[model samples]
Target: MAATSRDVAREAGVSQATVSRVLTAGTPVSEKTRARVMDAMARIGYVPNRAARTMKTGRTGTIGVVVADLGNPFYPQLLEALSRSLDASDHRMTVWVSDGGKNQAALDAIREGTVDGVIFTTVTEHSHELARALEQRSPLVLVNRTVEGADCDQVSSANRQGAGLIANYLVAHGRTRIAFIGGTPLASTTAQRLGGFSDRLARLGHPLPDELVAHGAYTHESGCRTAAQLLHLNPGINALVCSNDLLAFAALDTAKAAGIRVPEDLWVIGYDDIQQSSWRSLNLTTVRQDVAQLAAEATRLLLARLDDPDRPAIRVELEPTLVVRASSAFAPA
Candidate 1:
């Protein structure tokens, strides 16, 4: 038979209520008492069941994380950061891929009261399916994306500023005929980036024409197709700014296949400086989004919202820095 909280209390020479309080998070138990109770529970091999604790405290000590796609290396990095942050708060994470077949399972977990709160890591635009989730009772937070009038808090990078930096870098390096490849045009992220880049380029007197812009999913295949169409079909596009590292990687490979020398005949810049961007092979110049910081801020928002359900919604936009590399290096005149 498993050792129960009663056994722990007896071993610790404390009331069962005291042991229960120690098991609950954010309880006002004294440090000395907590330590003594923990030591006693460990010596007695006592472990409280999650179900009982949830019934007592009304908190499952679990958080649901809904990621739209994990195929991208960036998602995995974000997931790792979120896991670290959640663990630090003594919360366990249960993940479900929004685009995966198991999406219904995520909804069921919420309906069945399996998770305490939720974090939507990929809440992009035109997400009709998420309309239901947005109305759910869970104290949810959006990470890296947000919708207008969203009732939840959000944590994202300064996308517009990052995009402006790219535009400036390209113009400073003397690239005039630049083209942009965006992801999900209606998405707030894509809109902000494209708008910022366009505004900054126009201000710098290297205005991007309507014909030079392309839109597609934030996938390598999509970027490859768009890049090929632009490089082969369209003419005079000397610089390519991609929405994400995966797209930029695709653009680089496509440029090579077209026999174009990067930084000599053309230049490429991308957003979200993913790990692969630094590989000697890719050597991509891009915007660095602090994934760890994003995760931490999102966790903070979620925890705070859960703590104070009536708190006003907050939006956190962390600053992004440019990561220059060979991909966008200026050629000697």
Candidate 2:
């Protein structure tokens, strides 16, 4: 028969209850008793039943992460950061992409109490599910996105400030005919970026014309199509500001196909300084959204919510830095 806590207690010469306490680390045990139990377990190769432990503690040690699309390169980087952060605290992550939090998988996980909490990487402004989750006081955190009226802990980069910086840079560089490509209108990220860019440009006495502003899904294909649309509609556009890096890449390719010289003729920049942005072929200048910091802060907020569900919601916004490269500036020496 496999060794049980009883066998461990027998080998350690301690009471079975003492062994249980040591195994669960629940009621503190004396160092000597803990050492003895641990030694015996190592010798007997005893593994505690996780399900039993969860039943007693009421914590499954699992976190749920919801994202709109894992196919986006940025999301994979975000997941890697979240995984590393969670692993450090001895927690596991269960991810739900595609439909994000709107689908049955996430609903089932929450209803079945499989996840201790949820982190939303993508939440639309009109997400009724998010509103319900907030009302239920579920242990939840929003990362990189926020719902309109939902009250929950949130972690994201300073989208408005970053976009403002880009606008200033482009205007100062003598790029007058500027255009903006935005993501979904419902996304807070897209709204903030567009707001900041437009506000800053207007403040500089050069507002973007309505025809110069276009919207697209946050996908490469959408980026290409939108870039073509902007260029086609406004042939005089000398600068293009993309809501995200993927769109910037598409603009780069479409501009090249349209026989436009980058930097020399049309300057381009984007947000979310993803890895591919630094590739020699692309060399995109962008606003850097620190995925690592975002993941760490979101995990910290989720863990805090887990401990105290009644804690007041908090928002953490990290500042973004501008990375200037060949896409928006002259090549460096």
Candidate 3:
């Protein structure tokens, strides 16, 4: 038979309650008692059930991560960063993608006290579920995106400034008749990037025309469709700024299929310098968001909120850096 806490207690010459105290985190057990309990468990090969402990302490030791389409490499990269951060603090994560922008099952778990906290990476302005969580004062943090009028801790990259940098780079490279491919219309990152790119271009005396702008999901399919649409509508366009790297790659493929010469005819730039962007075949120029920083800050904020739910909400924005490569700029011959 497998050894239980009762067996451990008997071996340690301590009460079962004392054994549980030692097993649970932040429970006050004397060092000597803890040491004795540890030794007893080692001898008996005993392990505590996490679910029972969660029932007793009301903490599942699991953080809920609400994300978007995993098809985007950025989410996997961010999740990896978050996994490292959570593992360091002895916590696990359960993720649910925001399919069709409805995540009621995940929210139901939050209300049922199944998770210690939540981190939202795909929140939008009209998220009623988020508003309900806020009203209930749930321990949550927003990463990569934030909802307006929602008082919550958030961590994100400087989207507008990064787009401005793209505008400057393109203008300096003498790119005229520039076009834009944005993410979903409701996504805050798309809004910020579009605003920055358009506003900066306008200020530089190269205003972006509405006809040259297109919106789509952060997927390659959207990129192909939108890029093809823009190319067909205006063959004179000299550059295309995509909201995300996946879209940029799709645009590159679209340009290739249309027999459009890159750099010699059109320039392509994207956001989020995903690992695949550095490939010799793609060599995509993009704005690099520090996924590690966003994950670290979100983890820190959520843990802090869990510890003290009454604290004032805070927002942290990390600056993005422009990565120049063969896609946007010509390589040295």
User: What are the TM-scores, per candidate, against the unseen true structure?
Assistant: 0.90, 0.94, 0.94
Tens-digit per-residue lDDT, 170-256, candidate 2: 878778799999889888889989998899999998988888999999988998999998899889988899999988999999999
Worst 10 residues of 3 by lDDT: 100-109
**lDDT (Cα, tens digit) per residue for candidate 1, span 179-232:** 899888766778888988999999999888898899988788898999999888
Residues 1-333, model 3: lDDT tens digits: 878899999999999999988977899999999999999999999988777777877888899898888899999999999999988888899888878554566667777877888988988778888888789888889899876657999888888899999999888878868999998868878998999999999999999999999998888988999999999999999899998899999999999999998867888999999999999888999999999989999999999888899999998889999999888788222
Residue 172 of model 1 has an lDDT of 81
**Candidates in descending TM-score order:** 2, 3, 1
TM-score of model 3 vs. true structure? 0.94
Instruction: Indicate whether candidate 1 or candidate 3 has the larger lDDT.
Output: 3
RMSD of each: 2.8, 2.1, 2.1
Better of 2 and 3 by lDDT: 3
Query: After aligning candidate 3 to the native by TM-score, how far in Å is the CA of 5 from where it should be?
Result: 1.8
